[model samples]
Target: MTQQNPLPQEDQQVTLISVRDGNISVTSARALVVKAHKIALKIDTALSEPPAWTDEQSLTMIYTHGERVMRLRGVLREQVDTDRITVEPVGEVKEGDRRDYRRADVDARVYARSAGTQSPTEARAAQVALQLAPTSNAFIPQVVNISGSGLGFTAHEVFSAGELIDLRLVLDQPAAALVNVIGQVVRAVRGEGDALNSYAVRFAELSEADQDIIVYTVFSNHFAAEGLSDALDDFDE
Candidate 1:
């Protein structure tokens, strides 16, 4: 039987209204800090082949630090409507799986709430690390995959969706300045036996200089490396 991909009917907008320590509430638009240690969010395209649509549900999320499981909750609010989505005790928060679901391409327009707006032209690929100002939890992630506007990485700490956060990124090497940024934990995923947790993050705001640096350092290098690697592979063949 063919598996069905999970898709949202409309654009979802989540808000972190409050937080007591590590836990948070979605009452206003704010930056989100990632806390999940093992994330495995995948885009299931059961709604459309090659999925012409963009919205996705972080259908699965698991939070584990070392061997212990952490239960969590989140809210998904629609941008086009007043409907709100809440996921509680989010199923089973566990490891990732290789064949549990199809990895559909996600090209959604995810935005983070901030006092200011940063253009998508400022979007770039960079190794970002985050933590809540009040807490000492650090969200160190491994960027397993990325796109022009989105990023996929892994972490194991449990963070409520829509939580606010301060981000520091390791910009492209050589001049790898630790640039500050504000973003949200748009989506998260985890499975029964998967190795690493996966997350999809969207940037909310950044400085112009930092944005240029990111574009040149992160986005340019990624593609340039891919092109070079492909050429070398072709040469080898």
Candidate 2:
């Protein structure tokens, strides 16, 4: 009975998942295989920040081989700097199903405030007023994940489900976009940061044009992550 080998070849692309900014920001870091061992792996990654392991002291890789995609989960063995990590494979390697990415995991800035039963029209008017004359009451939240219809952010402001809120979203990727929209709190859960809660809000009756802007914002990063080599090349410089 000889030792098992996980990967036999090299130069394969893998999505190295990691969290940073005190776990307030989670990103899908793309990494290429630098070396493969009998039971461990070393990868070269492009992470925005140093690896901050989540609740589990492990590293997960979404590896695409042939036409089937697979996930390799293992505990962290080393930090090698240069965004590299050695993972000791824990379980057997197997192919996993490919998913249609609905939400983009991001770390953009968003400002939110509780609306307290205001209609969408009223909330929109209030958002515009604050933009012209910004107020201290505005809270900047770290966006965890976002889609066109809803978004989740971690902030100190506690909001109960079903309450209305106004948001000023500043998108600076692909294109610059400053959008104001009304949303209803759908969920709130415990998260990182000093006195923070993760709030999920669904856009409430957004106009067709406004909805389009958000949809583009959500996918812009997705495309940039898959291709757009120039976008990332300049990032390192």
Candidate 3:
């Protein structure tokens, strides 16, 4: 299939998805190489453990490069080795435009409170009220990664898709502060066995100042780790 977006960069972080019997399994992986209509992935070693895959099963690969997020559908082509798998694209690569603010992989602690208790009409109005009020029923979830636009985290509770939630994130670097925002759940993939379910949520009605903090923290942390000042300038441009 034809893709309007540029090809994925090598070594970019990717999430592989395989669905069977109505259950979707997602694994963290990386793109080894990107070719026309195909890509090779360094599969996660855990794939051998349980819920084995078959050649007939199709896969969805999601990855972010720069400000674009691409979700490509493909079928397993070959198992290159115990750790590598090749896949051939089955349809046009789906691309989504992200905010100028870049995403940084982080393991920071996040507390979230579901607004599911409120009616749908009320929830829409509540999200616009600005500050997120702390609640005794708040859940401390592990934030997988974050960007100005959205964040992904893992939680034991299965938060239904389209649910609205309030978040309070504590940042440790580039000046520590608490960030409060309302977000909508975009996707929730349950992990294998008893593992926590992973959720991807998109921020909604965030103030410009709050977004600046998220962007600065992400860029600061990322540049500090990579030690690449040039890339920082490029990101600003």
Best candidate (score: TM-score): 3
Better of 2 and 3 by lDDT: 3
Sorted by lDDT (best first), the order is 3, 2, 1
Per-model root-mean-square deviation over C-alphas: 20.3, 15.1, 16.5
Ranking by TM-score: 3, 2, 1
TM-score between model 2 and native: 0.47
- Top-lDDT structure, candidate number: 3
Poorest 10 consecutive residues by lDDT, candidate 2: 228-237
What's the number of clashes in each of the models?
Answer: 31, 0, 0
For residues 187-207, what per-residue lDDT tens digits would candidate 1 score against the true structure? 767734755555666555555
Indicate the residue-level lDDT of 1 in model 2. Answer: 94
The local lDDT score (0 to 100) that residue 105 gets in candidate 2 is 68
* Local accuracy of candidate 2 as per-residue lDDT tens digits, 191-236: 6656678888887856544554454445446555554323232111
Model 3 residue 17 CA deviation (Å) reads: 37
lDDT of 3 by residue, 1-237 (tens): 853765556775565656665444545456788898678888644322223566746876666544355667788888777667788987676764343356777545577668764354455466556454433245363545888688998876668788887666766554455676677889989889989788899976455445545654565466556554344232211
